[model samples]
Target chain A: MESPSKTYQPTSTPFDVDAIRRDFPILERKVLGKPLVYLDNAATTQKPSAVIQSITDYYTQINSNVHRGVHHLSEEATNAYEGAREKVRQFLNAGSVEEIIFTKGTTGGINLVASAWGRKHLKAGDEVLVSGMEHHSNIVPWQMICSEKGAHLKVIPINQQGELDMDQYTSLLNERTRLVALVHISNALGSINPVRRMIEMAHRKDIPVLIDGAQAAPHLAIDVRDLDCDFYAFSGHKMYGPTGIGGLFVKKAWLEKMDPYQGGGEMIKSVTFEKTVYHDLPHRFEAGTPNIAGAIGLGAAIDYLRAIGYDSILAYESDLQAYASEKIGSIPGVRLIGTAHDKAGVVSFVVEQVHPLDLGTMLNAAGIAIRTGHHCAQPVMDFYRIPGTARASLGIYNTRAEIDHLAETTRETIKLLS
Target chain B: MNSTKVAENSIQAAQDSIIEDFELLEDWTEKYKYIIELGQVSPGLPEALKTPDIKIKGCQSNVWLHTELKDGKIVFSGDSDAMITKGLINLLINVLSDREPREILEGDLYFIDRIGMKQHLSPTRANGLASMIKQMKIYALAYKTKLENAN
Candidate 1:
């Protein structure tokens, strides 16, 4: 919220991005005979060696399912898995371990809320409110359940700068508004919403909120207790961990009330033809043999972040983002999208007369990996009345020199295209 | 070059010509620039023909193709949302347009690989190219049926 990197405050590691880049082996790889400049962290991050090694170690040493087995391997594996959940609990500063439910990814977590919570409570005439800038993962699940329940899906609009129009958001809320689902940060535009304030406003009306922290978790230091959101969802892959693994942090009260999303072995206390009593808390939500290695890898990623200190990450990322934004924006025919006052490590822009796919192809040819499409946030694209914008999203290890190259190559690409 | 010409070998000849043209380009960037130029210069499809029914499914890029059975030869025209894809559409049009339905339906379509276009394409775009070819072949198959029925 404070002006990010206005006056540079030294990180604990003192902004040594080169050393951090070394932590990721993928950064060393060349693409098309040129060194790779990966700026697609918003889609998914490149795994650090610590995270990669953690997965290998889990498979090589302690490769067993957790919770049920009584063997020594099982206990070690269980400890590793649950330890990862505890790490997530600490990462978000949630109330307790009971609130942390591991799922497939951010989409799985949001769908859990939509199916379990929506089917139980939402009535025919209810309204499910979401911001216009949400990824399709956050939007489509609600639309599906809302359609089935005969509930209406309402969108809170954003301005040209991509900030939410707070007055409209307030006016849209009423007795029919059952829940407010919003993205903590826009994947398409890099707009950081004032979610704490939005959460407070929703809580005032007895309406719970779900923060899609898929983008936020990778960049910001998330504190669910501090934000006081009813539910938080994030993907491990976006945070330099493995794919097919993520977490959902539910308020304990909601966790107690919401029905089990899936009927599976681990989620059951006792299975009867008459009635199946569900397992308590996190187990009730986790239904299958979880991604064991992925969870351990996520824990390792958390450890990696902790070692570097999130304060350092925040400071360095802010500085990098500001410098990249200025550099990229200075290019002729490049129009920056989502120039929100409070932004993180994203730069979405459009070049005059060049399609995003062409631009992406051009960038790829030059050995930069950026996302170019609707970015799974088509509503934002529809609002802008464009097909897609080229997006360069940052990670903790990104250097200013790489950004300079990106900008330089982009200029050359535009020249060649024109 | 005639829209309804009765040339049988011209289709494959045109495919070879495209491959030759692409081989003259230095790199993927230059090849793409040529593709974009071809796409830009290619004729636009009528807005009415850009319907859902004519659209090729599973294409990462949106592509529409329309076929006309004229003078016993099938003429195909199409459009695409992305420039690279549009260029691909143009390439397909250049190769198969104004050819007999039977020749087009059974055409080699191997110039893409010969030109190293397949290697240059991203996986999604490669899928789009396949879909484009499939759509063009389907059009040819339809015209083949109509020609046989008339005969």
Candidate 2:
């Protein structure tokens, strides 16, 4: 495997990180009397002022139930809510607005497909393929549905560098393979899977694919149509939007055929004691009162990302990741966990004789927040034969100086613990 | 003093000394350094005793605690993968170990709070500090039952 630093040449384009940092209000706050250096982006990103204000505006101005009432407030609420759907549709470059279904987050989206699609299509002895690097969200839903359907859940193994074994993945694809669900970018190892090629491989076998884009959506520009995935799920919170609201982008063909995930008022076109008619594409999947403000906030988040552009985000973050890997890995006992050729800005490592939880606590005292433990990827931990790792995931707002501090503090903490 | 009173006084005395030691530390780093040193010197449970049955749940790191009744007193030994968690386990053992079941069950450990380690006791922290304390008392309750039955 090639070193990640050498794989991507750092762009010479200037990135205004200081100006970007000012956009997040929470960045001004200090932790433990020290200025905060938040590196837990893979868990959740800090919301910009625009996203925060959008949520505030929704409650303060509109504050009405959507798609039900005929009053002026309802009309405004309906437009804003539906407008957010349009924003998501454009964000993923999906074929139509009907493809975007509002969900609780990535977990909700995966569960929706695993229930609605899996229950309808899967048969006994059928197999669902998922990568070893998947977050628990991507793995458990399939496990539940597969067990219920008398189907099996098969894992596509990963190599030492945390890259998926492409040959093994191809061999795993067989006649009994019903679906392929994989994470676009690993939250634990920062490995960027060859998802596009993998999708094409599955397509050749007439098997549909679902891409868990929770980690990818914040960093990469997504085009669901280009990827041609059957389903793409992501979280709003991980992409500078409000929590409890996310999207599932299903292909139109699948949406037209799959059953409604839940039955409730908004999901029905007409209801009677004897019979009820389910609503159209997206609304059929979204039941009950939706997260109206959350959707609006996510729309504002999309607008913010579009204004800055993905070109700069990718270049700046890639450079930052490479720099971090070098600096942190230079420490005597520090071992970089993920050395994939292609990766996002997540850097996972473990120090010899120093537990990740101990490292995380010490860093917290210095106001440098990083995620520790198995990172909800226990299978990945088992593969490495270690308990867990200390992960410092980068975001667009982070600076090189923060990485420098992180490296220095990590060195001191390791010495103290050892 | 009677043996039971002696055991109770020793537990309180141990906690007070711990508090005094922590008070001398200047900053968070110094306090943590001292705790790590304590963990290094702590006698860990035997490998055979560190089984899944004794492992504490809800900890980010693995923690194994073993309790045994020796000469009418409960003896506690524990281990953790993380140094800080191990340090905390050592402190807990120091305050509660090698005491009669009734004395162990009735002991109120205030050193963690007095030494500014209250955050570790929060349920959300998931470091197993609170769980370890609860487990030690539970072992005491079980041993107390055994003593009553034997009598």
- What do the candidate models score in CA lDDT, each in turn? 0.87, 0.89
Off by over 4 Å in 1: A1-14, B1-13, B24-26, B40-81, B148-151
Listed in order, each prediction's TM-score against the native is 0.89, 0.92
Write model 1 residue lDDT over A209-281, tens digit each, in one string: 9999999988889999999999999999999889989999999999877988788988888988999988888
Question: Can you write out model 1's per-residue Cα lDDT over B35-121, one digit (the tens) per residue?
Answer: 888877888687877999988898866788888888999888889877777888888888888889888887888889998878868
Which residue pairs in candidate 2 have backbone atoms (N, alpha carbon, C) closer than 3 angstroms, thus clashing?
A: none
Error of 2 at B109 (Å): 1.7
Query: Highest DockQ among the candidates is held by which one?
Result: 2
**Which number leads on lDDT?**
2
* lDDT of model 1 at position A47: 89
